[model samples]
Target chain A: MNPNGQNAETRDGCAAKLDVCGLDLYYADFQALKNIDFRLARHEVAALIGPSGCGKSTFIRVLNRMNDLIPSCRVSGKVMLDGEDIYGAMDVTELRSRVGMVFQKPNPFAMSVFDNVAYGKRMRGLRDKRQLAEVVEVSLTKAALWDEVKDRLKKSALSLSGGQQQRLCIARSIAMQPEIILMDEPTSALDPIATGRIEELIGELKKDYSIIIVTHAMHQASRVSDRTAFFLLGELIEFGDTREVFTNPVDKRTEDYISGRFG
Target chain B: MKKRVFLDGLLYGIMALSLCGVIAVLGYILVYIFRQAAGSLSFGFIFRSAREGGILPMVVTTLYVVVVSIAISLPVGIGTAVFLTEYSGNSSLVRILRVAIETLAGIPSIIYGLFGLLMFCRFLGFGQSIIAGAFTLSIMILPVIIRTTEEALKSVPVSFREGSLSLGTTKSQTIFHVVLPSALGGIVTSAILAIGRVVGESAPVLLTVGLSRNIPRTVFESGRTLTIHLYYLTNEAVNPDDFGIAFATAGTLVMVVVAINTLTKILTRKFKNSQGDAS
Candidate 1:
């Protein structure tokens, strides 16, 4: 939390969409995240920037309990989404529906393009065909991929280019109407052109959804996010507005990382 | 360098000789069977009743055991595999089940024959019928289905599971929509292997499946499979014609296996194409 309490205060004076306090995660005996306090207001893109194994990916996964898949993973902390304890009271499936995620790799289900986008709604029991079609269209259009895929919605999603596949993943996330979308290095596997397209998509996505992206590229965080949090060796080194964090980091480690010094 | 080259040439010659030995034995059996079966390899011999020098009843019984055994085992085997791969995480029960499956696969067919005779035929009172034999064969093939399906499930990428779960699909739904579909090719291969085992086993069939020569109208009726009929014919051959019929039965079993192999390959290709569209 900032000294001025601005981090917790939203423009609308509502509770922060996400308020994470005193979070410490462990995998068996090995701690993966140190005590960290964070808060996210509505419609803000908060980018997590760190080197490899610095827990940026792990932190984003914490938001949706994706780490629950790991048998050894253990988490302690208050991860409250809209003032509800996600780890305590909310059902895992319900929590995930409200907090969508895009992985580091574009993992479109092995199905038709239309089916990939409609998977979430279908699983949630929306059996009406017209409703599903409408959701798919709206989601794809929001993800900035409708024009490229509208004609070939029946084609296999695997048939798309790597960049298009990433967009399709974003569209898949959007179809669920999640309040927050956590992206774990969503474009790290793509070419520069694809990465640029995703960056632009992230900018447009923040208008409707709270976006938290984990990226190894500092330039990407500087370019895409409104707030940037720098992590170092499982500890959060700095958290502030993206422009200020890039221009004048309070922590020495954050300055060293952003200045292209050793990570 | 010259000596190493000579050794390499010598090793290659030995491998080539071994390959030829395998091909020679296979070719010799096929040619000898075709020659000996010349008198009985007709359409009538295959389609007529046993009293009329045909093996139609045996063929029908063989198919019954194959179909019924597969139907009984495929789901159970796949379920065991899913439990091992998806739900049971590093538990000793999974390890024990794996070891049990491995041991069962190595057990002698005669032991299964005796067990089936006691359990299904006498105790359960199904009494030396097609159902009894199918039940016995289904148990015999469970290890094959479980092992192959386990491998198939493990081979599907972890990312697929994560992707599905992230969409708020339950574990079972993720399995149904992504994991199993991704592993469909392997599951089909396991079923084919189980079919191979069901078609080839004669000792167990002889114990549970009776030596009835008539076509079975129901699973409760006593019947003989093609392998069992071939065994009986070979054991009681008193004339050249009898020997001819025995060899013809062997030839027919081979034909059936080949036909099934071709049929499944075509069906699996179609299934793969359909899965791409529907999933």
Candidate 2:
């Protein structure tokens, strides 16, 4: 974190902002996202909500070029981080380091909890054992998993319950000190108790890092996000302040989606 | 009541018969080899040619073939399997590659021997030598290794890969660090099977390595394997003593392969246990 509480600037002021304009994504002939335009302010929490196959997860993956790993997947237009074109003049390794992601299913690496949290930091060449230990503790604490795992730091991450695994993944991502965290249905695999913990963790995370979460659960969007973007069939139907979008949606699709009429 | 009794009897009888057939055949072979080789079962028979001291060179030659073939085939086979199961796009090209690999695997050993003799021995300037034999063996076992490895790699749940990749790691890292470890036991089994194939081959070794009694110090040198030694012992036994030598060699080869297979089973179980505990 910067001492001034502001992100460092690149050539474009967009580093302080994440910009996606006229973005389209595809898998072979199948269009996944169509002309999706959205932005996330620095240190803000934004949620994307929609029915299954509505392209919410696709949008979050595009932010960090995770979609690029899929063969036959193609993208057009731009996604800028802090005003800088993250797709341009950036190595994928560096881009991924700056923009972290957590999956819908909690995927703690097959290693121990400490190693899982330390993985990202090690990837970025943080080899000092002392520094790695400190980072792992801080990250786990931030993810609200420190107390439960503090004693069994060396235990296999797979031994943890579902919720603990998810939190460990979050800690692993944050240990890299990424500027943005993109989550694709992060809590869908957890039970309500675990879901609540993840929601609480996301709430605290927004104070330091910008987050873009894709969710199918409307209540989760309302409960956690500051801004919500509602998508339908590859298009962004509506995006605005979460409360306004949910209570008084401007688009009928968004209204129908939130009110449970039909999605 | 009558129908149920008949059906139950038929089903149990068929299964028992199948099991009996397998065990009987194996037991017969073991007894025959042991009984036939009794006269030749000595330290001298294991250490030098029957004409000289024992069959040490043949044992060494078999080891050379197994090691070289495994070294050559393991990486290419496992890598191809990984590509097919993990990174392949669901496209016509991948489908074609898979079919081609299957077809290649189905090709007979004799045909593989012919191809090896023509290509590695004659065309590639390797000559009739252990190197040619190794190349032939490598090609012969490629399909077995590849198909087994592909199955192993595919069996690892997608959740494992997703778990690794979602943590900001790349696809390659996930494969190496997670998927491969999970499938290592299966891959090792494939290797053991390949080793068995290479060790048992006679026709390919005959065409490529030739039936020289001299011990090969390098892959490029001509040599005869245990199976080939067994064959000549049967065919050119000029004396009754040589027949005893052939049975002894056969028994020794069987024991070696059985030992290796047993070791593979033990190692695979150990690996599976460790991974289960680790995860």
Candidate achieving the largest DockQ:
1
| Candidate 2 residue spans exceeding 4 A from truth | A1-16, A27-31, A112-114, A125-130, A146-156, B1-28, B31-53, B82-97, B122-126, B156-174, B236-247, B261-279
Clashing pairs in 1: none
lDDT of 1 by residue, B128-176 (tens): 9999999999999999999999999999999999999998889999999
Error of 1 at A54 (Å): 1.3
Q: Each model's TM-score, in the order given?
A: 0.92, 0.83
Give the DockQ (2 decimals) of all models. Answer: 0.59, 0.25
The fnat scores of all predictions, in order, read: 0.65, 0.28
Residue-level lDDT tens digits of model 2 in B105-126: 8888999999999999999999
Model 1 per-residue lDDT at B214: 90
Error of 1 at A166 (Å): 1.7
lDDT of 2 at A21: 88
